[model samples]
Target: MSSSGRPPARTRARVVRRMQRAVPALTKTTMARMQAEMDWFEELDAEQRSFVSMVLQAGYSQFIEWYDDARDRETARATPPLSAAVFGTAPQSLTGSITLQQTVQMIRLSIEVAESELAAVVDPDHAAGVQAEILRYGRELAFATADVYAHAAEMRGAWDARLEALVVDSIMRGEADENIRTRASALGWHGTGDVAVIVGPAPSDGSSPEAVVDQVRHAARAAGLEALGAVQGDRLAVVVGGVSDPDKAGAVLAPHFDHGPVVVGPLVDDLLRAHHSAAEAVAGLHAAAGWPTVADTVTSDDLLAERALDGDPAARRTLAETVCAPLNAAGPDLMLTLTSYLDQGGSIEATARVLFVHPNTVRYRLKRVMDVTGLAPADARQAFTLRVAVVLGRLASNQR
Candidate 1:
């Protein structure tokens, strides 16, 4: 009625005094109701319970103090509720311990208790007006609770991403030490099963980086795998856990990448040795350009030839020891026949003529070479791999 938008000073002062007198009793009754009614509240440890009590006390005080000396509805709507002052002063960890829903229940119950406590203090004719304002005040408290929890959640998510990136970077950089192990455990990594690493271009489909990584996690979990991902510059590296089949895990995650070969490393027994897998994946990803038509999702083994040519000693050793050494051990006949076959453009007659043997003899020796090396020198890709292995094997032996 006044330009100050408040009730007459006498009435306003009387009502404010009555509300202030009821707060302590109201807060005590609310706490008692919460402990009896809320299982989560009763289950909190002593420190958290104390934090809750402090917040409850602050809530009631702030609710009373939050009111300007104004009685108009516009003034109540314009009031700043006790979001930060109530919850922010408590430990941030409390935000996680008490969920937003539970916080809502607390707000509702506190208001209910307040309504009853103040009912006897105010005149009966004005009780309805007092209760309406109290409920409006409680509603704003709920909004404040939501804002605090939402901010806590946002902060938590950011901290989680940074920790996850550290774990991935440590493994890729071959530094999976105790510190990284502890950090990965905090990220919920279970060290009980196979692990692998996948490297590819970070997806660029206009999705936020968080959304992309979240989808990768969702997809991996849906496939019964645990995945931790990080977008470092243009590349996305994911460390996958519980992988029974590394390629299957890769297939499940490949669609999340863009414009590059998605290379999966070999499966290792545990996270500690996952650096080996991560290393191979990084090397293969770098050498992927050498294979122009490589599949979208390829294993590091599939890129062995390119990696060997790209001067990865691990790939070179794998090729020479696994393919060339065995062929050489099967004796000179098998070695000579296979080399002549490759050098003479894979023609049986040409190879036999070069080795001075019958065509069937050349064929038989080629079969023996396949047995010794487990690589057929006939298929195009297999032939390329075999050729590189032979070259690398010779270079290695010549140096020796």
Candidate 2:
């Protein structure tokens, strides 16, 4: 034996020689087992297959080098069992194609092949040691692979969080430029669908913001929608796509937020107009406290009255344009009819008496108001909006 506790040089050569002869059969059997057992492995294209084969080849050769040191068992243990270069040689994109579980399956299959060939390679005395090392190396490699995947996932999550925040900030700032559009597309935004923004207080649940955003994305995906989101300062803003009704989208995400008003803006036709939705949702969030009877989730359109009362210029303008302008443009008769009906407790007879017209005439004008403005004066909530809109319109008209 050598002074270093290694076997004699001639003895060491015999052990390595037998293992080397077994390498070809081990490689063939491992590949065959993989082909039979792993459908994903067989389905890889030629280039990817070649890459996988090369990694396997490196793993085998690395094992032989590691096993050669087993005579000095402590030194073998100290030596890195797996080559760092082996895993690094494959393109990072390969991880995307081959899942960690599949990689583990491949590693375990290789080890099984190695154990089966052991008796043919080394004598029984050394064969036992080689088999034991094989199991140990397999466990180590599994952990190494887990570490690789975990690191990749962590890096990707951090990058996505930053990207999501960027997209959300641009929308909130109303910067729907081509640059922001490209970023949103990278974040899985479908440009062809209606889009809306929902905002609320960030959850104080103490989970990492990245985890919260991931949860939101997962939930949105399951609901057949695309979402981009992040917690910005104290507010959580999520832009949801592929939904027409803003209220339903808000409801889908409401449970993830803190206990407060979760507000959705009006749905816009596409992502480019998402900023309009974002502005309205943010304004509504600020004004939500004024309306105590609101549901946990509310729409920006639904909060227009409170928003206008809270001095949101957009809400005030929307009321004037969508409600009053249509009423005034339709004719003064609709305006006078809505005012008279509301003043007299929505009674058609009383309104007719006040307008000096037939009750049917009052009814006809009220129906016209509904058709022109989409607000039915008979409904208490809508009547309140109508009243606010008409008053704001008069103020705007007087200003003009």
Candidate 3:
């Protein structure tokens, strides 16, 4: 041993020379064996297979270089680390085609091939030393493979995050198109049913964007919904797909947001049209501050009056189209009776007297109004929405 406690230079050189000579045989044997033993190896296309072969050759060459240098403590202190250079022959895209486990299996097979060939080439006196070096090289290759995969995973995560943010922004801006659908597919968004959008304040604890998204996704999953979340400034927006009940999904995700009202929009048919839901949810989120007693997860439809009061034209149009137009089209009598009932603080007797009908007839018309507009005149919130829609409808009719 040298004073630095490394093998003598002559001994290291002898082992290195033996490994250099065994490279060609090692390459052929390893590739043949991998083709026969590994089922997935032969499935790669011609270019990928060629790249794999190149990787094997590079791995063999790098192992010899690393083993020889590792024996010399001073020379082994090189940077860029031996692991980073192990797969230098292959493009980074290779990782996308082959999994890390497959790579590690290939390395193990290559090490076996090297060990078997080295035993044949080296003299009995040096065979043990060479075998030990091959084992050490295998360990280094394993760690290097892990490093490569870890880096790949980090890059994939970053790309997925950017894609998710883009999808969310498109939905919020009501600009969802084919490109957004393709990107969502790449992110593995599997929502195929009713979709809704929820808006709330982002977590105030200064968590990373990834953590905030993960928290919202976890909550949404627990509620049996698929969710995609993004942080836009101080707000967190989550678009949930495959949800039949937006309010329930919002309630499940409410605790994950900061201390503010979490607003959910009405469900749309699919993600392609989720922008409508996103708009309503955003409008409701802005309008929610006015209702101190609002539920933690208030639906956008519940806040239609508030949203319209906040100057949201979409809310106004929705109120007019969904509430007033249907009632007006049902009949002037039904519309007048509903107006009278709401004006009289939902008193059936007063509405009946004003309309010159029995109280039961007024009750029957109220029920008819509920069926036509889906908003009952008795409930306070629905009544408020109906009244606003009536006023807006009258104002719109007058303008016409």
Candidate 4:
């Protein structure tokens, strides 16, 4: 063998000539065998099948040229690398139509056909030389195949990120429609369970948007949920699905945000209705700073008092409907008792005196308020929420 990793000129010429003569028949035989062995090949449409045939022919022709070049040191030095040249004749789209495993199987079949045909045609003295070249060429082809798939995977990941951002943005803007659903379908967002939205500051450490999204997705998966995240202005918004508990899901994602309150909206039916949750979460996020002791994962309902004080109309409506309307429906006595109890600084005796009833009666009415509204009067936070609801309810009545 020569230092250039080829047999001496005389022997190299014979082997190259034999390979050139055998390539056409070898390519035909290999394609026929591959079709017979792999059911997937037969399933491809005519256009795709023709494309595969072109790639097989190209691979064979390029291998012969590469082997001939290898025999001549100067030609080998002048030519592009064998791996790059082998796939250059075929379209990159072939990677999409063919799986990597299928591609490998095709390559193996081609090599086998080439070896068998060359062995029969070439001189017995030069068989070893031909076989060695086939092995070297096969290794280079395998590397080229791997590079193709790696590039495809990277392109796919980038496309997915852009699509995910668009979906999340549409949800936040309350513009979700069929187009948004189509995009989410492409992303495989099959969460048919509850969905919630969480809002907080974007990370301040200058991480790329993709990195931030990946971190949130990883955290969500760890907690058994699917998540879509985007950096909208200074805020990081994540819509988590398949979880009934927004607070629990929000806790998993809280660390991905900057140091601040992470507000979670109520759970909704699915991605299409996620806009309502997104709206509530954003409103709560804005109001969250007002409370000094706010929990890291505060629910939008928990922030109703602050949201109402900040003039959020939705919060006002929630207070009026969910809190005041129910109590008012229970009876004027319950409403009057609640108003007196809050106005009198949560004093049962004061409320009883104002209502001209026994203290036990006031306590009973308070329990009735809890039963009607789901808010306990004894808790300070619930007391504040009740007070806001009463004020908003009276104001709404005056306007009507």
Best by TM-score: 3
Provide the lDDT at 303 for model 1: 90
Model 1: what TM-score?
A: 0.90
Cα error, candidate 3, residue 267 (Å) = 2.0
Clash count, one per candidate: 0, 0, 0, 0
- The true-versus-predicted C-alpha distance at residue 265 of model 4, in Å, is 1.6
Candidate 1 residue spans exceeding 4 A from truth: 1-7, 14-18, 72-79, 122-126, 356-361
Deviation of model 2 at 70, angstroms: 3.6
| RMSD for each of the candidates | 2.8, 4.4, 2.4, 2.9
* Candidate 2 residue-pair clash tally: 0
**Residue-level lDDT tens digits of model 4 in 1-400:** 6775557878777777877887778877887897899999988888888777777787877777776776454543645654467666667677788899989999998888877787777877667767777787888889888997888788888999999999999999999888887898888788678999999999999899999999998888888789889998899999898987777888889999999899999899978899999999999999988899998788999999999999898899899889998998899999999889988999999888888999999999999999999999989989999998998888888999
Better of 1 and 2 by TM-score: 1
Better of 1 and 4 by TM-score: 1
What stretches of model 4 exceed 4 Å from their correct place? 1-22, 71-78, 81-84, 88-93, 119-128
Give the per-residue lDDT digits (tens) of candidate 3, residues 1-400.
Answer: 5675445788768868987887878888888898899999888998998888888887888877876776454553642455556677788889999998898889888888888887678777667767887898788778888998899899999988998999999999999988878988888888688999999999999899889998888877777778899999999999998888776788788888899888998899989899999999999999997787887778898899999989999999998889888888898988999889988887998888888999999989899999999988899878988888999999999999
98: Cα error in model 1, Å: 1.3
Please give the range of 10 consecutive residues that has the lowest summed lDDT in model 4: 70-79
lDDT, each prediction: 0.84, 0.83, 0.85, 0.86
| Cα misplacement distance, residue 69 of candidate 4 (Å) | 2.1
Error of 2 at 351 (Å): 4.8
| Residue 16 lDDT in candidate 1 | 74
Kindly list the per-residue Cα lDDT of model 1 for residues 288-389, writing each as its tens digit: 999999999999998999999998988988887788778877778887787788999899999888888899998888888788877887888888888888
Badly placed stretches (over 4 Å) of model 3 are 1-15, 74-76, 352-356
